[model samples]
Target: MLASLYKNNHGTIAEYKRIFSSSPAEVWNVLTNNENLKLWMDHLEITDLRKGGNIQFHFHDDLGTVEEITITDFEEGRVLEFEWGKDFVRFEIRPEEEGTQLLLKQVLTEITDHTPKDLAGWHVCLFHFADVVNNEKNHYPENEWEKWYEKYREIMK
Candidate 1:
């Protein structure tokens, strides 16, 4: 599903919500564990996991580009918020009666030409997250992202 975009005092916020049939513990494990994380977001790795620690984004290119993002807030099982360039990306997990509810919000300071790409990327990643949580194996859907990117581009315009 497309993330809902809205404005706030800090800036624009792109919010995504997903419900998983997995338990909260299972969902959190997939969200934070490195092995599971790679299945959804191959570029991101948790180098350090505390509030002041870092999450690194590796480009995996010939240049081997890497950027460190600080963990701004963390509560072991419930919340994880970190710096996303100048913005913030946060994940909040709640236990639901039927399963788990995962909420992801990216706080954007300004919408740029690249904003649609980021939003579409996250939208695709969330779909992967659901599959990972359900133990369903599949290849990354590059074509799906292109379709979402176009949708996001139209929305941004």
Candidate 2:
């Protein structure tokens, strides 16, 4: 069964799912490898992929950083779970008819409020993931990004 977003002692949780044309191994590599992650995700440092390992993400746009995410779980080519700040981020991969289905769950612990900016950033990031996996020459446009950011600010407030 799919994990549901729930409010717990920590915070709120958000879930997202997407199907990619790449194999599960490829997706797993992209998620785990720092160089491949940078192609889509922000700059990141992964100390290791084992349980109890630590990972860090640095936002390219603002110099903001996500430090010390402990690897709570890891299943080769299948699942990965880590503690990101007060939240937990989990990625699950399943083989599909075309390629693979990736389920991303972000458990927002300690964050009491929901903001559109947060959602918008996630939406854009997923779009970028799709674009990169599809080997598109140009990912998302600047105007589109600006629009999403604007919507984020407007809706968050």
lDDT of 2 by residue, 38-156 (tens): 77767567878888877876665565756667899988889889876566778899999999998887876554444444555666777777766777756467556566656645533
Least accurate 10 contiguous residues by lDDT in model 2:
1-10
TM-score of every model versus the real structure: 0.95, 0.75
| Model 2 ranges with Cα > 4 A deviation | 1-11, 59-66, 110-114, 141-157
Using TM-score as the measure, the top candidate is 1
Candidate 1 residue lDDT tens string, 8-85: 899999999999888999999998999999988999999998899999999999999999989999999899999998
TM-score (C-alpha) between model 2 and the true structure: 0.75
